[model samples]
Target: MLKHVQVRSSSSLLRPGGQKADTLSINSNMSFCSLHEPALSSRSSSYTSLNETQSSTGSASVPAAPPTTTVKVYTRCLRPDLEYKTMSVKYTTTCRDLVDQLLNKYRMKHRDPNLFFLTMEVATRSTGTAVRTILVLDDDSCPAQLQACYPRADSKFTVRMRHGGLVKVYDSVLMAESQYKSLLVSDRTSVDQLVQLLLTCYKSNESVHNYSLYEVCRTTSFERKLHADDRPLAIQQEWSSLAEYSFVLMKRPPGTPRSGRDFPLRRSFLQWSRNRELASWSGREISVIEERRSKSHRSPSLSLAPARKEGEKSFYI
Candidate 1:
């Protein structure tokens, strides 16, 4: 959607007594000032005469550069369920303006205007490195208009609620033990936040202090575990990039051996299941007999084989 902001007039003229004349006035939505051209021409002539006088008197007047409204930015909400909103904002638009617009478009029941904050999720041009989420300070202008923040591409901004003692987080995906959980986390949530969220979701008797978060990334051959760090944005970025992001709870550091007793029970159970499945299979199983019968019928027989080829000897095995 396109939204236009009105610009103040910059056209001024010089008066007869070495004073400035009234500034030119334009309508709010005026594409061009349609005032009498003759009046404008007279004002320009007077302004130019004053400039000539200034140059002859060894003083020069420098015209002020007109303010620009060239920047138009597109912003999207991080909320998956909400319809994505793309707005064209002026370069002079403040962060507060964008935040208000976002809130108005998607009303948040618990969001406090005073506590609202905006953050940007940034990624490098290359896929080798992970994305970074940086806080958008309210006092700062919109990063979308700044070339330094996003040099080659546009970034999505996320809304966060911050109270004196509490933080409102964005939507995040967390997986554990073959179960998927979508939860909201506090801004800049660390390992503690993950553990707390897990404890609440699972209703586990274990204390949060006793738990440690270990990230698990899987490959075709095997799974690798990395120690979860305290960086919230880093973790959020990793979660956003992955199709399936999960963390496991381990009593010890990853790669440590499990208790011997548990392993025997698990192994015996798996073996028993395998044996039971094999025993349940019928001898007439189509896959097993079909290929075998095909091979047997195709076997070359000494007596039934074709007669010896011309100039070739026939052998019996």
Candidate 2:
């Protein structure tokens, strides 16, 4: 049976340690040898294929980088000419990014980047009647998101010097009677600088010398005034204090003597008459009548007057 089982041997498989066993198995059964040869070859091919597949998978595992996006924006300087500027930035670019770019570009052209910042006036309503100027904060979102707040696409913006602050709406007689000037002052501006701003409206020659910032409060229609310390950004507290605030610019007449307090209690004829009438309605009212005369009275005369009857006329003897 071994003589009849003639097997072809491969020199590569005929190693000194392994050929004898292979030959013996082949010689034992010819049909079994044929099936075993294919199995051995298939095992080697499958191993090589697995190694190639692993290498291919290893190279493919590194993820590809995601793409970036950019957007274009336009800016206008709030000036006589309304100078225009254009910029292209990333989708996630912020106010700081645009401001820095603008500063650099402006410096290149005009050679001055100091105090300039990006700003835009956003309309408060759909009818485009009123608008508020908002300083583009560093952390604020991109122009696309800002458009949602502003709503008007054609609305222009400005790159101006930081020079103003927000003042709260107060319902005082002075504020109601006078034209409401929205004072937007820079945080770095001094009280003296604010006095200069007030001078523009009042246009008094003595404004620079006499005008000063005051802490003015009116409780029950009695106006109380205090001299505010002169400092840079003195009214910073009032700058953001939307409601609870009492600050005013008062222009004292030239050579007019001021007491310990800036605004003294001296009633005019009308104010005195009004006070008298109001006191009569209250039945019994103690009144401090401050009578002041120019040069005649060195100081105001303060006298406490007892409540009089409706028909009584008192004499100062």
Best by TM-score: 2
Clashing pairs in 2: 163-186, 164-184, 164-185, 164-186, 165-184, 165-185
What are the clash counts of all predictions, listed in order?
0, 6
Encode model 1's per-residue lDDT on 101-139: one tens digit a residue.
665666542333444566665665456765665646563
Tens digits of per-residue lDDT for model 2 on 38-132?
77678879999999999999989978653333333344443334356666565566665676676566553221232455555555545756655
Models, CA RMSD each: 29.4, 20.3
Candidate 2 displacement at residue 278 in angstroms:
54
Off by over 4 Å in 1: 1-80, 106-111, 125-133, 147-149, 152-154, 164-317
